[model samples]
Target: MITSAGPEEGKSTTAANLAVVFAQQEKRVLLVDADLRKPTVHYTFNLANNLGLTTVLTKQRTLKESLRHTGIEDLSVLTSGPIPPNPAELIGSKAMKQFLQEAKEQFDIVIFDTPPTLAVTDAQILANLCEGILLVMYSAKSGIDEVNKAKELLLKANGKLLGAVLNHKKAQKEDYYYYGG
Candidate 1:
């Protein structure tokens, strides 16, 4: 699962990139937009969001029926269907666990793009289900305290922190210089 301390910190981008990378390596990858409140995976992949995670969870559609092919070999996406009034409840539902089990059995890698930890409880609810959580922090934009708080929240939810990724870091001139033999 990929999330951040706050919004606009590149969580979705990281999840999408990771899925693509795994797919390139010949692994079957499924990138799920678990951010029910504000989904962006459909937009990122240029896929229709008419039916997706929500539809599957509600039993309105099967997982296979809701999955959207990304046109990239071994890569599929399950976008957040529609904005629901109770996202947190839906995420913590038993159906969600069943969905995860089914997805894991089908894909080599199941990456979820979740909402920010501080912004909603959706990510925290999902933390317990996912094997690990990757927190994406915006360089120079995210405060140390906010990151720590996000970490604390995930840990409290029994989530295994898989370390963090620093995004949007401006490169300095010295960064371009490399030592070579």
Candidate 2:
């Protein structure tokens, strides 16, 4: 999953929340902090940034060395290790591609928290990598023009654009419920 917006848009929070939902369903999920340019998944989860995905990508460390066990049982995380100078080059490299391939085989779902598409090429570079990209939008914050630009980037990448996830849904009408039981 590629969680991003222009900027200051709570992309990481959305991604982390999704991980929580998946874990609640008993799925073995691994969160990959692919946003090397500005990584915050680790911080969101309150995990260490000592070592992670960058280590695996740069081949300075192995996958076993980088994959850290979060407090959540079914969920693990690979943080963006030691922010590198060439984050775009690294993520768009052959090694990152190879790592993702192997990761799919190991975990049920691998969620990638990447940079905002409009802010940098990092998300666009990563959009090409994942099976699906989820465009996150903030209520009353994101404009149609910015979204359209992102859509264009998505088109150029040949990404499997899953759909948009509308966050911060404010209730305009009174909350209603139907009994299923």
Candidate 3:
């Protein structure tokens, strides 16, 4: 799961790019839009928002039925379907765990784009369910205190912190990209 201290930290963008990279390597990748409150994976992939994680969790659709394929081979996406009134409850429910288990078994890599750590408990909840959590922070925009706070929250939730991603870094040389660990 990819999350940050707050919004617009490039969590979704990082998740999407990582999913594509994994898929390009011939690995079966599943980009799950777990950001039920404010989803963007469907928009990023230009896919439908009809059926997805919410649908599966609510028992309205099976995991298989909710998955949509990207034009890139071996890449599938499970967009957040129908914004529900209770996002945190739905994400922390037993059904969400079961859904994640199933997804883990089905894909080589399951990349979840969740909400900010400081914004809600959704990311913390998902961090516990997922194997690891990647913290994304903008270069100049992210405050040190907020980043630390987000890290502390994840630790409290027993979420594995897999290194931080420094995003929106300035360009210096040809190899200098926007984001790096």
Candidate 4:
């Protein structure tokens, strides 16, 4: 699962890129837009959002029936379908656990693009289900206090925090020169 302290911190972009990277290595990847409130995975992959995670979770459609194949070889996407009213409840449902089990059995990597930790409880709820969570933070824009609070929340939920991605860091010329070789 990939999320951030707050919105517009590159969570979705990071999740999508990670999925593509894993898929490029020949791993079967499924990038799920678990951000039910404001889903963007469908937009990112240019797929339809009529049937997706919500549909599968609600038993309105099977997982296989909702997964959309991205033209990017081994990548598939399950967009947040129809933005349910109770995103947090839906995410925390037993059906969600079943969905995760089914997804893990099918894909080599299942990346969930979740909402920001501070914005909603949905991320925290889903965090416990994920094996590892990656918190993406916008370098200058993200406050230390906010990041710390988000970290605390994830830990309290017993989520295994893999690490954090510091996005939009300006590269120093000297730093670039060191790696230019």
Candidate 5:
């Protein structure tokens, strides 16, 4: 799952780009719009939003029926359907877990774009279900206290704390960005 402490931190963009990169490597990738409250995957991919994760989770549609090809080799997307009144409950339901497991079995990588951790409990709920989380934070916009709080919330939810991606970091003349273990 990809999320941030607050909105406009590029979580959705990161998830979409990651999925694309994984697909470019010849891996089957599924980019899921799990941010039920405010989904953008449909817009990002120019796909129909009538049926998707929420539809599958609510048993209104089959998973296969909800998935839409992104015109990218080895890549597919499952946009969040109509926004529900109780997004957290829908996301944390047992049905959601089953959907994720099925998706994992069908794809080499399943990346989810979730809401901001501090904005709602939706991200925390998803974090526990996902293998790990990539917290995106704009270097110039995010504060240490917010990051710390987000980490603490993840810890409380037993979410795997994957290393964060510091986005929009101002690069210096001699500086370079490197990401690896």
Candidate 6:
């Protein structure tokens, strides 16, 4: 699953929460911080990003070396290591392609926290790599115009859009669930 929307729309937070939800369901999930230009998945989880996706792509570190076990048993993360000068090029490069191939084999379900589709080609490119895309929208922040624009771009790229997620939703009593990890 590739989670994205416009900038600062809480993609990282949504991704983290999704991981938590998946964990609650007793599923092994790996979250890949693919937004190399401005990655926040690590920061949201309070993890270091000194060596992650960039390192793996530059060959300075292999995927295994960069993958961090989030300590949330059943969940792991791969941050965007060392911001690259050419983030778009790197994300669309052969290196990232190979990495996703290996990731698919390593994890039960891989979640890519991607850059906004409108801002860069990163999300569109990543949409191709992941099994499905989950576009996140902030209630007051993301306007219908922006959401529609993003939807058009993803659709043009043939992204497997699972659906749009409305974040910051007020949860009623029915929203709560309990399960051991």
Winning candidate number (TM-score) = 4
What's the CA RMSD for each of the models?
Answer: 1.2, 1.9, 3.1, 0.7, 2.8, 3.9
What lDDT tens digits, residue by residue, belong to model 4 across residues 91-178? 9999999999999999999999999999899999988999999999999999999999999999999999999999999987788787
Over 1-181, each residue of candidate 5 has an lDDT whose tens digit, in order, gives 9999999999999999999999999999999999998999999999999999989999999999999998899999999988989999999999998998899899999999999999999999998999999999999899889989998998799999888999988877556444321
lDDT of 3 at 18: 97
TM-scores vs. true structure, each candidate: 0.97, 0.93, 0.95, 0.98, 0.95, 0.88
Ten residues in a row with the worst lDDT in model 1? 172-181
Model 2: lDDT to the true structure? 0.84
lDDT (10s digit) by residue, model 2, range 1-181: 6655687676788788888789779998988888887889888888888799989999999888889888888888999999999988998899988899888888898898888888888888888888898998887888889988997898698878898977776855444433332
Error of 4 at 93 (Å): 0.2
Report residue 148 deviation for candidate 2 (angstroms): 1.1
Lowest summed lDDT across 10 adjacent residues in model 2 is found at: 172-181
User: What is the per-residue lDDT of model 6 for residues 1-181, given as tens digits with 9 covering 90 to 100?
Assistant: 5555588887888788888789768787888788887788888788999988899898899988998887788888888888889988887889988988888788777887888888988888777666788899887788899898888888787788889888877766655654321
Better of 3 and 6 by TM-score: 3
Clashes of each: 0, 0, 0, 0, 0, 0
Superior candidate under TM-score, 3 versus 5: 5
Q: Give candidate 3's whole-model lDDT.
A: 0.94
* Model 3 spans with C-alpha error above 4 angstroms: 173-181
Total backbone clashes of model 6?
Answer: 0
Model 1 stretches astray by more than 4 angstroms: 179-181
Native-to-model Cα distance after best TM-score fit, residue 15 in candidate 4, in Å: 0.4
User: By TM-score, how accurate is candidate 4?
Assistant: 0.98
lDDT of 1 by residue, 1-181 (tens): 9999999999999999999999999999999999998899999999999999999999999999999998899999999997788899999999999999999999999999999999999999999999999999999999999999999999999999999999999987777776421
